[model samples]
Structure formats: structure tokens, C-alpha cells
Target: MRLYKIMIVDDEAEVRQAIARKIDWRAVGFEIVADAENGRDALEKAETLELDVVLTDIKMPFMDGLELGAELARRKPNLKLIVFSGFDEFEYAKEAIKLNVVEYVLKPVNAAELTAILDRVRGTLDAEIEQRRNIRQLTQAYQESLPLLREKFLLDLLRGPMDPQVLEAQAERFGLAVREGAYKVAAVCDIVHGGEGRPALSDELVPVSVRQMLSDALWDRCGSEIVLGVPSILVATAWERDPVESLMRLLGEVCTECKRILGVTLAVGIGRPCQSLAELCRSCAEARTALEYRAVVGLGKPIYIQDMERLDRTAPEWDGHREQQLLSVIKFGTREQIAAMVDKLLSDGEGEWSDQSRVLGILGTLLSILRRCRLGEEAMLGPRGSWIKLLAEDAPMEALRDWLLSVCLNMSGCMDQRRVSTAKRLVEEAERYIREHYPDSGLSVDRLCEHLHISQSYFSTIFKQETGRSYVQYLTDVRMEHAVELLRATDDKTYMVAEKVGYDEPNYFSYVFKKRFGVSP
Candidate 1:
């Protein structure tokens, strides 16, 4: 409903006033701004005033209608023009057509007829405005998507370690012309804060600032580089002849800037140089390893793959004695002792290693010891009973150490409170397995004992000792519960319920159901 500004032009003031008063210009989506006595004066006002529509009489003394329309068209090509002429000659009509005039109205013009001409001109103006607005909006949206597109491209490149030809094709398509050279992956990360699993809201903008600063600083050294924002680090892929030196220079420049702007120093990690795009994943892994080194090398410090390799040459291999002592505490020590072991593992240099696989192997060893010691509680680690559930490479070391401490203490507490032998845990695990596999007709105590690598006699003794019921009784109880629910909640036949709960013989199922519930099916 926005009104387009209108300008009236004629030799006589009476004619201009009559035209302006002939219609409610506001209702027709046009606003009358000013009146001019001649074409020469109207041209000046049209140029300076930013008028949208011009209504002018053709017969004027200086600079007649056709000459004014042509000059205005050359100057303000977007302005809508309507010509008012008493003479309906071919020359005037042809000249108006050449100037792209929108409408030609005969003067002593009819009010209703001129009003229709003005309405059509108003529609034309509205359409032009809408088209320009749409173009501007599309331009703004495309500008905003550039950063997100760049981030997605970088992440996908590293994840794929994409084939070189495919990588080249994608780079060309996305307008990223990465130079062909050896490349290293570098990451800038915030220092771990207060054992939280992730960074605080105040630190969320740090990665964006880090990416911008690093990309700007490295522009001189590496012409083409990709900076991406990720959860744990601001990842950058820069290609250069001397990648190691480039990474160090990048680290020195950005770390100082981060400290100055963010009020916190950033930890830097640089991966080894890789020759091809296919090797990017390996470089990315090495970069994460370097980042994890902040745990030992100290925060706000840079770590390189070569530095880790040089340190690994002299650092003793896994300390079997220390690992054994740690495992012993996890198996039977008090809560305080277990907590002390976890704190030492994270705070001291007990778990440091140049090879990431070795650290994971040591973690696997800890998990094995817990399993062997019968750590049989769901809440020991987290809601889901998988040990590796929360053990992500990007997880804060302090948080992971806290998790280990809590689980170890829970296991140690269990060992102290009850005679939870391996055999007892075995039987309890069998019961759990049975609950999950109750629909399988092949499930039996013999099969479970075989799977657990224990004698049937020993398994039976501990199964009863732990559960206070025979395995058959426990399985029957689970099946009966399922069958009763199916019977009440479903329209399924008795035979279908029997088969669903692992009873092939429907008659025997009905007999047992009556015995348990004291009712018929």
C-alpha cells in the first residue's frame, strides 16, 4: 500500500491544478509531490526530487514534452512517464513511443479515463519495485550462504580425504582454488574449563574469531586456505611448501590475537604434512592427537606431530606396574584410593603417549579389567551400559577422568558390599541376556553356560545363589509377564501370544498361565 510520488507538469497552473484534483492519487497508489509550468523545469525537479511518476502536457514553451521525456529517460530510466497532449498527431505519438512513455492522454482530458491510465501506470511501478526488491533479497541470501558453504566444503573434504580428481572437481565447482602442494591440518581450541563436557556459551564465539584471525594472518603466506568452524577446534587447511613452518607461524600470530581479544589463550595443534587430498584424514587425526597433548604439554602451548615423535623416542613404553596398581585399585580399593588413581592418571603423565592407538589400548585394558572384575551395574558409567559411550577423543580429559573415577568407585563399592564373584556376574548377565532374548525358542541354560565358558554345574550353583531362583523359573516368569500383557492389550489369539512368548505348545502355555494367574485365557 506504499504510494509512488507523482509530479504534474503543464504550461498553465489551472490545468496542473485540475489534473491533481481530478483523482484521489493516494487511493490509486500515487502521491502528487510538485507542479511545474514547463518541461524544462519539470526535468530538473524529476532529477533532484527522485520522483516516481511524471504527468506532463505536451505543448510547453521551453523543452517540449518529447524532448523532456527523452532526457529524463536517459537520466532516470526507472521513472514512469505519462504524456498529456491536446494534439493527437502521429509525430507526437511516435516521439512518445521512442521515449518509452507509458501513456498518452488527450487534454482537456476526461477524469475517469485519465484515472484508468494512472492506475495502470501505478501497477507497472509496483511490479518494477517488487522485482528490484526480490533481486536484492536473493543477493543478500547468496552473500550469507558463502561462509556456510565454505565450512561444509572443508568438513567434507577432511572427512572424505576425497580422491584428488574429485576433490579438484568439487573445488572448482565451489570456487575454491586450492593450490597443489603439501598441506597440514591445524586446530585452535579453547582451554578446558572446570571439567565441563563442552565449552560455555561465552566461549562459543571463540572459534569464529579464531577462524577469521588465522585466515587473515595466513593470507600472505598461503594464498588459498580453508578455515572451518567445528565443535572442538577451528580447523584450517592450508597448503604450502614448508607446512610445518607455516603452521608454527600461524600458531604464533593467532594465539597472541586470541589472548588479546578473547581474554583467554588458545591451545594449538598442528598435524604432519600430507601429499594428497586422500591423506587429509590421517593429517586430521594427527592434529587431534596434538591437541590432546595439551593435557601434558600445558594449555596455551603449541604441539606438533614431530615434537610428539621426538618425545616418544625417549619416553618409556607403557608402565605395566603402574597399570597393574591402577587396575588393582579399581578392582578392590576404597573410593578415596580409586579417586586418587583417576586423578593421577589425568593430572600426572601416566596416560600420555605419542601413539593414539596405544592410549586406546590402555583404555581397553582398563575396560577388560573392569569386565573381568564383574562391574555389573548400569549406573556405573552412564545410563547406557557401554564404556565407550562417553569416551570421545574431543571429550575433556578432566571430565573423562571424573567418569572413570565414579565408575571405578562404584565397582569397588560393589565388590566390598557383596560376594559378587565372576560366576555370580555371569549368571546375572545370563538373566539379562534372557530378558532380551525371551522370544527366541533356542534360548536355554545349557547354551548360556557354553557361551560363558563355565561348567553347567558351577553355573547352576551361582545362578541360584545370585538370583535365588532357577534359570527356568526366571525365564518362565519373564515369558509369563509378556504373555499376560499381550493377552490383555491385544486382540491376538492365544496361540499367537504363546508363540510370541517362546511357548510353541499353546496347551502347556494355557495350563501355566492358569496356574500363575488363577484364571483362564
Candidate 2:
């Protein structure tokens, strides 16, 4: 226990000395800092002394102890005071009470009584100090963990094109088991008000307790080998078997359970499996493509690219005239016309579109048109981009169609400028890469350069100059934008959303999503 500073005041020198000498101040955790023969002197000394408790005689010359106590009360409201004197005058005691004195000890102060008072004060002070320390520790811990949390989140979005070393480092830092051997990505969405506008689904908006309940429910049903990627959920299960089927089943169960128990609708999109973290971005794109289908297909369902048999085998073949016509229509068409065209193209060969061969055929047609529009050489044309290129051999038709539409919309702004046609093309290509490989959990600039056959410095410079943002910034923006769509249109778990956006770590994804949208995913 720490000792508290005490001050003694009395008109009689003998009385003051007797009290100070009689008490073993250290035994009870107190030390007398000053002694005064009069109230006036005591008041003056008190001003200069750092005292915790004051013991004073009421009746004194010049200024009474009452007056000194009143002045001390006004100056140091926190200081404790005790009154001691020969007179047992009721009036004086009453006055002491009015002055907020701690206690009134009779004429002769007893050591036992004084010790008790000091002990009580010590207890109070210790408690207050301890509380302050705990608060400081808690604040410091939260601040220190912020950066680590952010890195963990980006690593979870491992489905994009990224450097191997960077991904390995992130996995090690975050305690993530990057099963470079096999993994599957899934996109989760929550249906809200018919998907009319962006919705606020943050912890503040929906309550963290409720979000936890939803997350636990999904995890309980999906198994523990899953990582929530924010606004998307990535379930990394073994691919030795039919992983897509298993993923689809888990997604279906989650959607059904969420709707049945929480009274909220959900939709899920499962991407093709990848062998390593480098292909996460493509997985993210697949998830987003699944989410976009909600606008046309409605909610309370799951869209598995693997299940769309027809679109699974389609491939793009060059067609100059048809490609030109599609570009002209997209560039010059009215919003209504564009919407109608979009609907037609999305619905076309709805039956045949399910066929992988026919789906590839349509993708080929769309890409040719996109290419002829001179959208740029870097623009992703279906299975031609980096991330998606990895999956071109076996990707589904629905994935291809979804990828085409997504690329078109993502580069829609580029169409506004024909002079920088190359920039627009690169944006398109980047979009394709992002969609197809967002789930690799290891996509980054170094890896992107390797895929594009360009130098790191050159790639960085061109990507920034064309997109007006750093590669990471652009990727985050796109992920967050898609996250907003999922939050508004479906009732998928927050972790599921994280995975959909190429994030394997849900917590980190939520942190970044909060920073970008001013709210958590």
C-alpha cells in the first residue's frame, strides 16, 4: 500500500506535537507532511503542500479552522478534512459537517480512530488508480491490434492475382492455414427492399450481437474449416472430391437456415476451386457475378457457376462485325435500350446458355464485340484475362456471361473517352482479372506483373495512370462496391460477404469495409 500525505493544524504546539508523535503514520499507510501552530499558518502551508487529508483544531487565532477548511474546500475540492478540538460544541460539529469535513474526532485524537479513517481513504484512492490503469491498457491493446487486423483482412481476400511471398507472409502473420493445395470461394448476399439502393448492414446498424448470432449459425452449419471474407465467405475445403457440390450444399443450407431462423433472405454464388492463394481474385469475381444475377433472378437462392452446365464449356471466337454492333449499341444506346439489351443478352439461350459449349460461344461473341469496340488490349475478354485465364479451360457458361457483363459495366466509364482507348481496354482486362481470380487469397502487383509479362515498375505506373488509383486502392474500391450490393440485395452472413470479395479473414475484411463505407460489412 502507498502512503497518503497528511497535514496537522492546531493552535497549541503541545497538542499538535503530541498527536504527531503518538501515531505510527507509516503502519496505517499515511505520512504527516506539515505541522502548523495556527489555522492561518496551516492554510498558508496547505496552499504549498500536496496534502491528501487535513487534521485541524476548530478554534484558532487569526483564522478559525472552519475558515481555513472553507477556503481549502473551494480550492481543492478533492481533499479530505478531519476536525479535532477540546470543545464538543454541537454548533462547531454542525459547522464542520456543513464544510464537508470527513470526520470529527473528539478533543484528544485516538490512534486507532485516525488509523481507520486513513485506511478508508487509501482504499478509495487505490481503486480509482487501478481503474484508470485498466482503461489505459484496454485502449492501448485495441489500437495496437488495428493494423494487424487490417492485414489479416486483405490476406483473406486471397482469391486475386498476388505475389506468393506476400501471401505466405500474411498467412503466417494472421495464423491462417493457407491450404495452397485446394480451396473453394463463395459469395453471400442479403436481400433487402428489392435491392433498390445501398443498405446499411454494419454492426452499428444491425447490432454486433445479432451479427454474431448469424455468423455462428452459418459456421455451425458450414463447418469450422471456413474463413469469412466479408460480404463474402470463403470455405476452403479439400478438392480431392467434388468440392463445388459440397460448397453448393453448404451455401444452400446457410441460405435456408438464415431465412428460416432469422427471417432474412440470402443468396450465394460459389466459384470454381483453385489450387493456390494466387487465384482468389477470380473466385471473388465469380462470387460477384453470382450476386449480380440476383438483380435478374431475384433472391432466396444460390447460383453455382459449376451448376450452370451449358455456360461451363463456352469459349470466345473472334467476330468483327457482330462485336462492332454490340459495342455501338452499348456505347450509344439509351439507358432503357441498354437495360433491354442487357436483359435480352442475359436471357438469351437461357436453356442453351446452360450448356458449357453454347455459353462459351456467347462469351466468344461478347468478347469479340468488346474487342472490336477497341475497348483496349488489356480489357479482360471472358476467359482471356489473367485471373480468369487460369480457369478458362473449364469455367462455366454462367461464369463467362457474368464475367462479360461485369467487365462491360466496370469499363462503362471508359466508353466516355475514345482517345484513351488503351486505358479503357486495360481497365476492362483488369476487371476480368479481378473477377476471375479474387479468391486466390494471394493476388498482388508482383504476381499480376508476372501474369501480364510486364515489369513491376511498368505495371504499377500504367495501372495507376489508367485507373487514377493504386492497384490495391482500385481493388479495395471494387470489392467494397460489390459488398454494398450484396448487403442491400441479400441476407448472407457478413463473413460470407467477405469471402465473396476475395477475403478469407472476415474480421479484417469488415475493418476495411468499415473504413471504405463508414460502416462494417
Candidate 3:
């Protein structure tokens, strides 16, 4: 029940008071917010107060009520006008009708007639509000049906190399303002799949819940976080630049709150910031790529493109053989094998990407792995992979690789979590395999599982349970201990030292050692 705010206008102060006192305003869903001496004062007050109705007398000084009514009707057509004049001239009545208010009132105004008219005004206001509300809901529904439009627009903006004028016009069509600033696209798709009790394939409400939180949290700084996800998953998109930290922080807060209240875990991928829509598209692709690593980092966390970029920078130069082996894992590997393979591929490259061209080449090799998997081609043909156009190009060595890896992982169904009961025997077998093969430079959790003919994800989980450390960490501990013993007992070149410890790249081997021992070999 909304109160229709109103104002009373009369030249004489007594008449205005008499009318105001005669009515029980609250009873009729109206409130007399102000009383003006004449139409001029009433107009000023109406503008300031944004009143809903104006009650005026035709006779007044410094602007009469009829003149005031005409002016107000032009400016605020929605405002209801009730005029009571002493003169009963037909010309005045005709002019009053043109003003388009409630109705012209005759003086001395009757209390009941004015009261009934005020009631009518309240009803009109109520009806108008309801109509507007209905229109908004309908608009939202229509928008929902055409999500592909927004997605395509966003996809084009993110895919890159579009003419600026064209992209700007497309953005305008979607009600998006492409402001000039370094905008980063964050892909929030990496949702953590929990164990048995984790809600089975989230309800559609999951997407709705996230969008609501985003609206409440981001307000005007962002557009609606359109759900760019499949039925089982919730992938969302957002682009931001100014106050990047605030955006991230707000997202993090929403993630935490959603997890607590809605039992949802979200992984956010922050892209490298870039100016212009094309670059932003590349950044978006990079974000989606970073999102693929969220599984490696576990759930309930935000992954930044900076973190992935750092990994790309520090990772050892690409290994073709290792990459081929990774492709094999993707082909035959279980969920865990694919997960561990991705981890090993990245981990082995720690501290290796030094040259830009080399990084570009390595990134190409990574994308090639996806192409071999055909996951890239599949997604490229789908609605989501418009940005996959760059299979291999100079590409600034940035997003194409990340996009490929993300798409491959998505296709591998790496999020395809297979819950296995932790078993003591499984852990013991993993430990035995590691102790025997920790010295093999090519040995990995994936390989260890393959040798044991166990599910990689299952083996890794149980092994973590028994050994209290990841297989990689446990293996590193063994190698580092041996390296320390060798450093103490005999003199060997650092590269030789690294090789004996099962690290093919001596620099990477050193990184692991320094991380463990806090000193370079």
C-alpha cells in the first residue's frame, strides 16, 4: 500500500488549512506533504518533493491554479491535478480538461467530492506502478529466452580482433557500455564438485542464486552475471577494470557467502586486464583457461590469470614427449589420471618459461594436445568456443593456449569426479610404487596409477590419506633428502645433482629443492 504524496495550493493561507484539516489523509492512502500559497510555490515544491498530486484553486496571486495545472501537466504528466475554481466559466472547464488531471472541481469544494477524487488518484497511481512492474518482469523473461544473444555478444567481445566501432555498436545493442579502460574478464566456471553429500547436480536455482548475489554485491559496476553454463554446471561471465580489487573482493565475498548459505563452491578466474573489447576477449579466454586449474587448486577458491600466467612463466620449457604422454592420459585416463596429468604437466614446467617465443611455442604444443583430443574442435563447433579460432598463431602467446587447455579439460569431463572410499591397501600400494620409482625422472602420479592399474583419482586420494602428503610432495621429500645427503657426502655439479633426484630440468629440480630446503643446490 503506497501512500500517494500530495500538495494543496490556495492563495489564502486559511483556505489551504481548512481543506488540509477537513481530510483524513492517511485514511485515504494520501499524505499532504506541503501547502503552497500559489501555483508558482506549488510547482517549486512539487519539483523539490516530487509530489504525486496537486490540489489547486483557480484564483491565486503570482500564478493561478489553472496556469499551474497546465505547466505541471506538461512536466509531470503522471501527476494528478484537482482544481476547484470559484468561477464556473465553460472556457475554464475546457482548459481544465486539457490539463489531464483527475477532474475540475467546483467551489466551494465539497469535502466528500474531493475525498472521492483523492481515492481515485491513489487507485490510478497503484495501477500504474503495477503495470510498470509487470512490464519489467516480462522484459526479464524475454531477455531470458534470448540468452544466446548476450552470450554471442560477450563471446565476440572476448574472441578478439573485431573492429572497435562494430563491437561498440554490438555492446550498445546489449545495453552494455564499453567504456575505455583496462577491463578484465573473469570466468567463474570452476565449481568444486564435492563428495556424496554434495548437492546432486545443482538445481537451476543455483544459477539464479549466484546472479542474485552478484546483483546485490556488484550493483551498477557490472552487468547481470549471465549464466553461461550447462544444466549440470554453473559458468558465469563478468568484465571489469576500474576497482579491479573491489570486484575481486566482492566476488570472493559472494563465493564465501554462497558456500555457507547455499552449499555452493565457486572458483573465479581473473583474466589479465586489457583495454579495448578485442583484448578483453583474449583476457576472457585466458580467464577460462585459468578456471581449468581451479580443480588443481581444489574448490572454494578464486584463481587469477596472474597466477596461471606466473605458472606459465615459471614452468619449465615444454616437453613434446611429456605432452604426448599427457594426450595419452586424456585418451585413456580416468578422471583422476587427467587431473594428475594436468598437474604433473604444469608442475614439471616449474621455473622454465624464460623466452617469450619459447613460451609461445610451448603454449602451442599445449593447444596441440587439445587438438589431438578433438575436444577443442568439438567446443569450437559449439556455441561456447568462438574464441578457439586461434589453434596456432603468434597470438602474443597468451589466451589461445589457456582456452585450449580449459576446453580440453572441460571435454575430458575432468570435473567428472569419481568418489572412491579411502582404502589402506590402495595407499600402501601407492607408497610402495613411489618409494621404488621416486628416482624415475618421468614418474608421476598418473604414471604410478597406470603402473598399479588403479584409478588415478582414487589412488591419489587414498595415498593422501595414508601418507598425509600428495604423491608428488612425498616423492619430492624422498628426492630432496637424497639430494641433501649427496650435497653433504660428495661434490656433484648442480645439474648432476638434479638428475640423480629425478628432475630432468636441473633448474626445476633446484626450484623444488630450494622450496623444500630454503637454499639453492
Candidate 4:
């Protein structure tokens, strides 16, 4: 049984003394810590003692019980208040209710009634203390899970797009401070036994060791979050001009040290530099593409996507790069994007036909894509090799252009149907989660994405397209609806209502309410 510190306040000293004498402070799990003649005096005394309860009279000179209770509520929101008075006035009772007074009793004090009130206060205090303990335990658990949460954030950064503001907030929450500079992404792939066509056998510790080494190497040069995964360690770095080259040098050293120290060889794929963290997903994708070129650049080195682009630019004939670009457009690009890319590939800058070799390369790429999409090539090209006959005829440019556009657009339509169904499911889940968790003040887009096991960028895109509002806007609307209902159905105060509707700061909640409804809460 813990002792709760309490104070007694009344304008008359005799009444205060009588009230103190009527109760067994210790027996009721309380201590009469202080006594005062008026609300002002009690408030002054309150500044010195950490009190759990205040028993004060309703009509006190200098300041009344209502004023003192309001001030105390602001200073110590959890403090319990009880008002007792000689006169029974409905106005006083109304004010007491507004002040969140736990009990309003009439004087002269009755030992039995006062003791019962104190017992109830004791029970309330006990519950509050237990709640505090639980929150402390939760806080400790959160600290313990910080590392895993931070890893998830890094993975999110690499896997999908995050708005700049949301990205900064999430980074700050995870203790990953965002610096003011450009960022670049790198994929440290081909671990000891985690490369393509290789089995991941008893090499889980290799990535952990590589992450530590990478951290140690980049700790002074730049800030890096190295995410350890099978087959690769994704590194996002804040670096400056000559970013790719600088990263290549740093990664080369990490690779050398890794091999020399751990008896393992690895390759690094570096992406192009991005101006902001939001663009990291693109950089990450490019980095993964760079990893595929390890066979050409040889393993145990840092391969850059820019270097591959330079090679593609210098190639005289149709190459793998062109084939990849066309296939990507058909599979993932929008209809407009697919059309523009095909037109660019077929036109020789002056709207004339490009050379036959380039047209042939694009045709072959489309054939491969059709096969991959499980569509019959003959259905697309009319009896397999007949596309070659069409290519060799006069005025073949228009025919080839129209045929290629139709095929790419049709593929895009098929892809979009599947994508739209997935997007609808994602949006539905998001709405359900928001509705269920609207009262949670910590609910955020990052948390929602984590719950859905998807990227923030993808989720945000689909959610806005489907709902015609951002996640924050939608959450705000939901909170406001519940808040309006609570206000209409209950006598809860504005602060209480705010807490129930997922706002930790009552002032901010009121501001939002006013902004949305044009009236203060």
C-alpha cells in the first residue's frame, strides 16, 4: 500500500482542521501533507509538494475552488480534486463538473462520507500508478526493439518511395538523422555463399560481419545505414560531388578489407546519385541493375550503372540495353510512356525510319516479352518470322510503328488490370486499419505501410488515387468524425475529447478542429 500525498484547503482555518481531523489519513492510504486557508495559499503550497489529491472548499477568498482546480488541471493533469462547501448551489455543482471534480460533498464534514471519497480516490490513484508502470514497461520494450524498427525503416527507404516530410519524420523517429546533402544507394551483393545460382549455406553471419565492416569504414566519411539481407547489404549514404566515384572508392576498400579479413570475395553495385532521400528507391533499383553487370565488369569490384549506360551509348548496333529498355516499357511503363519510347526507338531523330538493325532488335525484344507474358508470338507477329517480311517492304516504318504501339499498349492494359485489383485490395486494407486505429496518436503512414508489408510510396500512390485524399487527410477526417460524435453524445471536456480522438496535444487538436469546422473545439 503506497501513501498518497494530499492537501486540505479552505478559507476558514477551523474548517480545514476539522476536515483533517475527521479522516484517518494513513488508514485511508493518504497523508495530510499540507493545509491552506484559501485557494491561492493552497496553490502556493502545491508548488512545493507533489500531491495526488486536493480537498478544497468551494467558496474561498482570493481564488475559488473552480479557479484552483483549473490551474491544477493545467499544471498536473492527473491530480484528483474534490470540492466541499457549506452551501449547496447548482451553479457551484455545475462548475465542479466542468473542473472534473471527483466528489462534491456538503460541510460540516462527515467522517464516513469523506473516508469513502478518500477510498475511491485511493483506488483511482492505484489504477493510475499501475498504468504508469505499464507505460514504463512498454517504453523499455520499445527501446529494445529500436534496432529492428530502424532496420525496417532502412528497408522501407530502399524498397519504396516516401514523401520527403514523412521520410524525415520516420528517420527522426528511428534515430536516423537526415543530413542536408545528396544521397546515393549501393547494393553490396554476391556475399560468400549468397550470389545468384548459389545456395545460402551457413553464411548468415557473413552479412552481419560485412555490415559491421561497412559501418566502421563509412562511419567517418559519411553517414550510412547498411541493411543486411540475403545476397546483399543495401547501403544508403549521404555524400557530395563525384558521389559515385567516392562511393566506389569507399566500397572498394570495404570489399578489399572484407576479403582479406573474412576470406570472402564480394561485389558492389553503385547507383547514380540522387538529390533527396525520396529518390532513393530509383537509385536502389539502378543499383540492383548494376549488380547484374558483375559478369561483364568481373566480380570483386564496384560496378556503376552510369558506366553501363556509357557502354550502351557507345555500342554501334542494337544491344542488350536497348532490348531491356523496350521490355521495361512494355511491362511497367504507362501507355503514353510505352508509345513515346517506341517512337523514339523507331524514328531516326528526323521522323524517318531508323536503320533495319535497330528495328529488328526491338522486334526480337517484343517477341521475348510476349513469350514471357505467356502470349503467343504468332498471334502478335502473324506466323512467327512474318515480321521479317513486313520489315523488308517499302513503307514498312508506319506499319511497324503502329503494330509495335498496339502490342505494347495491349500488354500495358493487361498489366494494369492485375495492378488495379492489387491496388484496390491495398486501399481497402488501409482504410480498415485506419478506422480501427484512429484513436492511436502514433498511427502514421510508415506504421500503416509496415502493417500492410508494402512500400510507403506505393501505398501512398494507390491510396490517394483511390480515395482522392492523402493518408494524413483521410486520418484527420476519420478522427474528426469520431470527435464530433463524442462531443454530441457525451459531456466530456475538450481536452478529454481530444485524447479520445488520437491527439496528444489538446491545443493542436483544437486548432485542427477549428481549421476543419471553422470553430474551436
Q: Rank the candidates by lDDT, best first.
A: 4, 1, 3, 2
lDDT of 3: 0.60
Q: Give the CA lDDT, 0 to 100, for residue 467 in model 4.
A: 100
What are the runs in model 4 whose C-alpha is more than 4 Å off?
1-319, 328-363, 370-402, 413-428, 455-469, 490-500, 504-511
Question: What local lDDT does model 3 show for residue 171?
Answer: 71
Each model's lDDT comes to 0.63, 0.57, 0.60, 0.71
lDDT of 4 by residue, 112-142 (tens): 9999988998888776444333434434543
- lDDT by residue (316-346, candidate 2, tens digit) is 2223444544554555555555545544555
Off by over 4 Å in 1: 1-149, 163-165, 191-204, 223-226, 311-521
Give TM-scores for every candidate, taking all chains together and pairing residue i with residue i: 0.33, 0.32, 0.35, 0.35
- In the range 1-521, model 3's lDDT, one tens digit per residue, is 55777889997888988898888999999898899877756776765465778888888765777789887865454567877877655356556557556767678778898888888878887764444334355355435644687767765555445888887788777765444334535454444546435532245445555555555666555543344455322223345544444455566556654564456677776565555555665555556555655545455545655533332333122234656566445534566776565444444367332334444454566566544433344543344345434543445433543553564466555323311212555567677777777778878765776665544433554577667886766887888988898888888988888888787878667766776778888
**Count of steric clashes across candidates, in order:** 0, 84, 7, 0
In model 3, pairs of residues that clash are 158-281, 314-351, 314-352, 315-349, 315-352, 316-349, 316-352
Better of 2 and 3 by TM-score: 3
